[model samples]
Target: MEIIILIAVGMLASLCGAIAGLGGGFIMVPILALMYVIPVSDISGTSMAVLFVSAISSTIAYAGQKRIDYRSGLTFAVAMIPGSILGAWTTGVIENRVFFVSLGIFLVLMAISINFKPKKSRDGFLKPNVSRSLLDASGQRHEYSFNMTFAAVVAFFVGFLSSLFGIGGGSVMVPTMILFLAFPPHIATATSMFSILLSAFVGTVSHAVLGHVMWDKFIWLAIGALAGGQIGARVASKIPAIAVVRVLSVCLLIAAVRLMFKG
Candidate 1:
């Protein structure tokens, strides 16, 4: 019964994640913490494991539709791996409550940014010839010239944050790609998922080594998420952009509040 409940929750969370292009860790962590009595300290690691499964499933599904941008994905992924490892190491030192609080604040800010009314144009479309270069939240440059050096720096930081917070780093990566690098939202999402796949896999391994993973629980969750993601993706394509954005804003706001109060 417990396992069944978890799988159900995972499916729901993954559905939302696929639609929104989030990694689903935010939803999974809180749900597990509250319902299963999972330790907050282990939430990041466990969430990474779930994310790994969801990323692989979503990537495969999207690939079949030819939606993935391989060049962008590979370039960004190459930079993110090392950063994830560093983040995994850092997790050992930080307090879980502090991390959760910070994550809450980040989510709230992200929601506001996403929901902010655009002053420039009502044109919902992004321009072509937009550069693929990115400037992360830290103000570091991640150029599109396949600059491995710059990518490495940015990927490392992003990876660290992903591991530490259990997010797919899309929350950070998408905005960075769109606002700084000028990539369209859909393209950024595709690229971000590709990058997240690598980081989440690496983070999961680190968590397993640290004995923070709950395999029995994770496997069931993955199964449900895989199925749910496909459904979410289909729905996402049919929904209006304004409606999607509104839904995302509400979800983020709720998640932020929950995380903030959880501590």
Candidate 2:
């Protein structure tokens, strides 16, 4: 029965994470700590294990749909590695209360930012020095530009938070890419998932080394993530860009409120 519950959680996490590019960590970690009585120390690593699997599965699905912007994804992912390493290293040093409270606050801010008067490149407010063009699976063309410096800076922080919280940083990545980088919503979501693979892999290995991983439950979560990720990726391809943002914002708000109380 416990095993069944874990898989169900994994499925829910992967489904929502894939849709929002949040990597389900925002959902999984709080539940594991507050409901399942899992230690906060182990939650991050276990969340990472689930995220790694979902990321890979979703990336494949998105790649086949030609939604992934590999060039941008790779650039951001490379910049995120150092931060990922550092975040994983500090997991042991930070107190559990501090971790949860900080995470709760961060999520609250994120929820407000993304939901209230959302920002996008479509407004024709600003233009950057870089330009990019890509074609998706449906042969739809997307072209945009953004400030490389801003993107790199955002990527660094995203990595840090991702590793620290065992999330894919999609909560940050998706919004930043769309608002600052001028990326199309679908493209951002797919690229975020692709980029998460690298950071999650690093964080997972680091946590495992630090003996924070819950190995007994890893396989079940991973299995559920793989299955749910495929469904999520498929659904994402059909959804409107604005819908994606709204769903993510709601999830963030809910997660933030729940986590604040849990902490």
Candidate 3:
């Protein structure tokens, strides 16, 4: 029954991740603590493992649909490396109460960021220094520009938070890309998942070396997450941009409230 519950939770997390590029760690970490009574170290490790599996599954679908921005995603991934290492190192020293409270507040901020709708680029709301245009599977054109420097700074922080908490940084990346960098919602979600693959891999390895991961539980959860990720990618492809943001914001807000009380 416990295994069954993990699988169900993994699927739900993956689905949420695929839609919003959150990697579902935000959902799984809290659930593992509240329901399964897993230790913080093990929970973070397990969540990272599941996130890697889900990222692969979702990235494949997004890639096929041509939704991923390889250049920008690669840049973000490169910038995140140092922070990922630092975060992994710091994770062991952090107290659970502190971690929970910080994560809760961060999630609330992310929820607000996602819900914020900016004006047109010409209105000077967005930095127009860098220009990019992507054609999705449906041949629809999405265009935007962003400040690379701002993105690098944001990516570094995202990497640190993701490694420390095992939340896969998708929650941070998607909103930052859209709100801060002026990326299209769908492109931001896809690119966020694409970039997270590397961070998740590094974080997973770091946790494994510390003996924080449960290999037995990881296998079943991974299997469920892969399937869910594929389904979510498909659903996201069909949804409106505003609908996706709504889903992202609502989920983050609920998760934030729950984590705040848990702390």
Candidate 4:
């Protein structure tokens, strides 16, 4: 029964993940923490294990829709590796109580970021200079600009956060692409999931090496995520872009408060 319940939760979490490019960790970690089903120190690792599987599942689904920006996503994903390894090392040394509170604070900040009105970004070392255009399977044309110079730097931190909090960094990646990279919301989410696949893979391996993953529970979560990933891709196509971001913002706030009161 516990396994069954966890699978259900995993499905719901992955649904939110695929739609918002969250990698399901943002939803899985807090709920597991709140439920006290596992040790706090192990939660992030377990979440990463789940995220790794879900990222693969969602990326495949997104590919079918042709929503992914593979060239850019691959570059950013490669940039994430060093930071991911470093963050996994750091997680092994942090206090569990401090970890939960920190995760809560991070979630609150993500809520603010997604809900905040987007402003035009100024030119800097990170300035986007390269233009890109793509036509999706649905006949929509997307035009955007982003530079690898800034994207690589951001991807490094994104990888660090994915390992540190087990939220898979989608909360940050999606917004960064949409606001700074000028990517359309649908494309941003799709591409973010692609980058998350690589980051989660690195983070999960690092955590597993440190014995942070709980394979017994993580197995069921992965199964549910596999199914949810397929459904979420289809659902995302029908929803308005604004609705997806709004929903993510609200969910992040709720989860943030829940985690804040924990530990």
Candidate 5:
């Protein structure tokens, strides 16, 4: 019964996550804690497996629509790998209460950033000016001119948080890409998901090596998430962009509050 409940929860989380491009770990982790009393040490490992499966499933749907920007995605993925490894390595040593508190703060800030309307870009923002250019996986020359040093620093932080909290880092990565890097929301979502896949995969491996993964539970969760993700991706195309963004922000804010209270 417990396993069944988790699978159901995974399905629901994946559906919302697919539409928002969030990978659903934000939703899954808390619920798992409240209902199953799963240990924090194991949550990241299990969630990473679920995230990996859901991402692959969602990507298949996005691919059909040509919504993925492979170039930007690949570049970000390359940079996130080492960062994720470092993060996973550090997870066991971190205090759980401190981790949750920090994550709460980060999520709240992200929510506020997402809700803010900027006037310069269509999404009401401007990309930061920095100078790093490279060919994306799609063979397009993309430039990242927003203080490479700062971006790397931020990426490292994001990666660390993701490992600590069992999230995919999309909550952090998407906003960073949009507000700081000036990526369009859709492109940012796609790119962030790609980077998350890499980060989650590496993080999971690290956790597994540490004997933190619960394979039986994770497999069932993955199965449900994959199916739900397909449905959510299909629905995403129908939702208005602003509506989606607003809804996503609200959800993130709620989750942040919950995490803070837990802390």
Candidate 6:
């Protein structure tokens, strides 16, 4: 049955999303469209709703791991809220082809950035103004820095991307954090999920208000995504930090290609 398929897809997508901090909306949107679950106009709305549920589940698990950067997450969340609402309002009005292509280009660039580290921090790479030192559940210590002004600016747009693409913006946020903000993969993934939870909530509500969410379908997806999220957080915790970035880079490239074609 379609419900069964939805559950399966939600679980698989959420598992991948949680591991990569993508939040699964991008994966779900394309498939849901193919299934004719709803009109394309409403697809993003539905995806955002499901994404919020998945994020909630994953954020809780990541929190337990003590991997999330709460200060950075809150700063990003505050900036992203407005963009989430605005993106929902403009969803059906934008040109899908152009947006998709632009996002694809951006992802490709991020992937390249990840594969090739700058020769040195002085090689014209961004350096953060504020520093943080965190000890995760594993008792491994991580020290990182970020520019608050820059992160706020990026998060505002990240909120728009989350709602606009229904991808939770983690596809973009994780790489930015790791590459630019000096966040370790574990911390980046966890922090990205935390920020995404807040953005997804705003985006979901905006879409629901516009009557874009299909509650009947959302229920099944939620059930599956919820379980998958917990599993993914566990899996990610076991992977080495370098491996996580490698996996994230691969995922970004994959999502970029699919999104371009979907557009």
| TM-score for each of the candidates | 0.81, 0.92, 0.94, 0.89, 0.85, 0.95
Predicted candidate 1 versus true structure: per-residue lDDT over 211-255, tens digit per residue: 778788888888888887777766765665566566566667767
Cα lDDT tens digits, model 2, 105-165, are 8877766666544453443124476677889989999888777777877888888888877
Best by TM-score: 6
Kindly state the number of residue pairs that clash in model 6. Answer: 0
State how far residue 169 of model 1 sits from its true place (Å): 1.9
In model 4, the runs with Cα more than 4 Å from the true position are 95-110, 113-126
Rank by lDDT, descending? 6, 3, 2, 4, 5, 1
Per-residue lDDT over 1-263 for candidate 3, one digit per residue giving the tens place of the 0 to 100 score: 98898889899999988988788887888887787666677887888888989999999999999999999999898888777777777775777677777778987887886676664641112455667878888989988877887898889999888888787798778877877788888888999998898778887888888887889989988988999899999999999988888888877876677667767
Q: What residue runs in model 5 are displaced by over 4 Å at the alpha carbon?
A: 119-152
**Local distance difference test scores for all models:** 0.68, 0.81, 0.83, 0.80, 0.71, 0.85
Best by lDDT: 6
Q: Which runs of model 2 end up more than 4 angstroms from their true locations?
A: 115-127
Cα lDDT tens digits, model 5, 207-234, are: 7897778898888898889898889777
**Which lDDT value does model 4 have at 215?**
91
The worst-scoring run of ten residues by lDDT in candidate 3 lies at 119-128
Give per-model CA RMSD: 6.5, 2.2, 1.8, 2.5, 4.0, 1.8
Off-target runs (Cα >4 Å) in candidate 1 are 117-154
The candidate with the higher TM-score, 1 or 2, is 2
- Candidate number with the higher TM-score (5 or 6): 6
In terms of lDDT, model 4 sits at 0.80
